[model samples]
Target: MQYLNGKFQIGYSIRKNDEEFVYNNGFLYSYSDDPEGINEWHNYKGKKVSSLVDPYEIFFYEPADVVPGKVKITASPFWTVTKRGDIHFMMNNVEGSDKAKNVHSYKKASDSEFTHTTEFPGGELRSVGNDLYLISLENDRPVIRKAEGGTNDWTVM
Candidate 1:
């Protein structure tokens, strides 16, 4: 299976009694060489994962495997010193959601990237793209890279 642009791609092929499936960039393909075999596939793009299957059902490609579970939420202190030597610090958290309460603060580095730090429920500092940051929930996990892309230059700390 492969994913790109927030879409899932799958492909399948069958030869004799053997069937093969492959997913690439939000497209699903299936092939069966057996004269009497059934060829099946689905395109899951722009659809929520919960809509297709039960969230509790465990599959070979379970998304929950990559996400975290509930934990005590804590906030982190944010501090930033721009290239110009200006210093700034603050604590920021989302309003309304319980998950937001866990957020400590965010630090901006560029228009597309920044770093977020948190201590409640869990502890981790995530670097957002090139200049902005946001708090992530326990079950929230970034996919990191697109399938078509060769690789991501960003490092996970």
Candidate 2:
């Protein structure tokens, strides 16, 4: 133990081979060289426990201007909801490759379900200005199409 800058300094270490030393902004530190070697250096803060939310049964919130409420769905989301102005778009997971479909109906309270076709996961939902679109790989091929709808009705583009 030693005192530096009018503060008590202490050291604790384990034996490591690969990790030689650690250097900070202005101070150089030397750790105890134990017979056992260390391969990697890690800076740990503390142990913590946390809970994760399920992707399926995720909740979608409506725009404040249009509506002020939250909606939850039990469907396994493929990617995530892409926004197009006042509208949100995404694809729904299904049984097989051609079983999944595209969905876009989380804009306003008056918004209705707009399913297109059998889409798959790993797909992307995009929108240009007010136009929404979806692109995905089907049958080992890349497919791009426009989402044919606005705030309510949606169809295959």
Candidate 3:
């Protein structure tokens, strides 16, 4: 792995090292060895994506080994930043193709400190005014719930 100022350089092989899959506030840089794949770097803001840094962070994601119970949380693909500027994401208790995913909101006190604001079993996140909502499919019926307050504050609906 060759890094120029903490970034991987050309000729770096991901198979040989554990390079940071992502970094910066909301910048996601990925490199895949698939012959048909391309190495790309991009940033996403709101519903828009750009090659340059955007004005906001749509989502902030960090992956880790699954820890049972307390430490077992994940930041999966369906994520977004709320209008109030809090980072929101989803996770599952386990890993694999068919595991149940849950929505979770967390604020980063630092790079290593992620404190949960709220969590629920659902599929998506959307905000109306300043309130947060989660949607899920329960028994084949659509269920929606709202967060009661700021991050870490909620009243189950």
Candidate 4:
């Protein structure tokens, strides 16, 4: 039951009665101390699998490290630049899907990472004096929304 940084080290044995198997990179690993010294490897669905040469070589990944409910961006993002020269965009996810199509901002043009600004409807994003505003069409009419401070709260104007 020894782990380092959420990864189970090799040769560590779990309790025999522990029905929960270990998983790493979507592969399940099971420990055994039988006379033949063969470890069982299975998929997440409990089906037997042999994709790995040795199960002990695999490190069990912690479930908390796995990102839940992550979805892919389905369309192009509306990009805009702030007055302070920062970049921002409103990304679009799949239509009619429960996933987020949120707005994100970058501190600089060369930055590889983006900060999540707020969950916004499909719209054209504009930066007004370093503030984010969305111009979206709602009910066949154009609506303007402004972000409140640095939070996800927005106000329709």
Give each model a TM-score.
0.18, 0.32, 0.43, 0.40
Model 1 agreement with the true structure over 27-143: per-residue lDDT tens digits: 112112223323322221222232223322111121111224332212323333333212122333322223343232222222222223344332222222232232334457642
Order of models, best TM-score first = 3, 4, 2, 1
Q: Can you write out model 4's per-residue Cα lDDT over 76-113, one digit (the tens) per residue?
A: 44555444444443444322224333444333434433
Find the candidate with the highest TM-score and give its number: 3
The Cα local distance difference test for each model comes to: 0.25, 0.31, 0.38, 0.42
Pull out the clashing pairs in model 3.
117-152
Where is the poorest 10-residue window by lDDT in model 2?
23-32
The worst-scoring run of ten residues by lDDT in candidate 3 lies at 9-18
Candidate 2 collision pairs: 16-38, 17-37, 17-38, 100-119, 146-157
Q: What alpha-carbon RMSD in Å does predicted model 4 have with respect to the real structure?
A: 17.7
User: By lDDT, who's the top model here?
Assistant: 4
Worst 10 residues of 4 by lDDT: 9-18
* Higher-scoring candidate on lDDT, 3 or 4: 4
Stretches of candidate 1 above 4 Å error? 1-74, 93-139, 143-157
Model 3 lDDT tens row, 18-90: 2322211121222123233334432222232333233332233333222222222334334444444344444
| Per-residue error (Å), model 4, residue 105 | 4.3
Which runs of model 2 end up more than 4 angstroms from their true locations? Answer: 1-84, 94-103, 108-122, 148-157
Q: Write the per-residue lDDT of candidate 2 for residues 92-148, one digit (tens) a residue.
A: 432222332334333421344332323224356655545555677788888766643
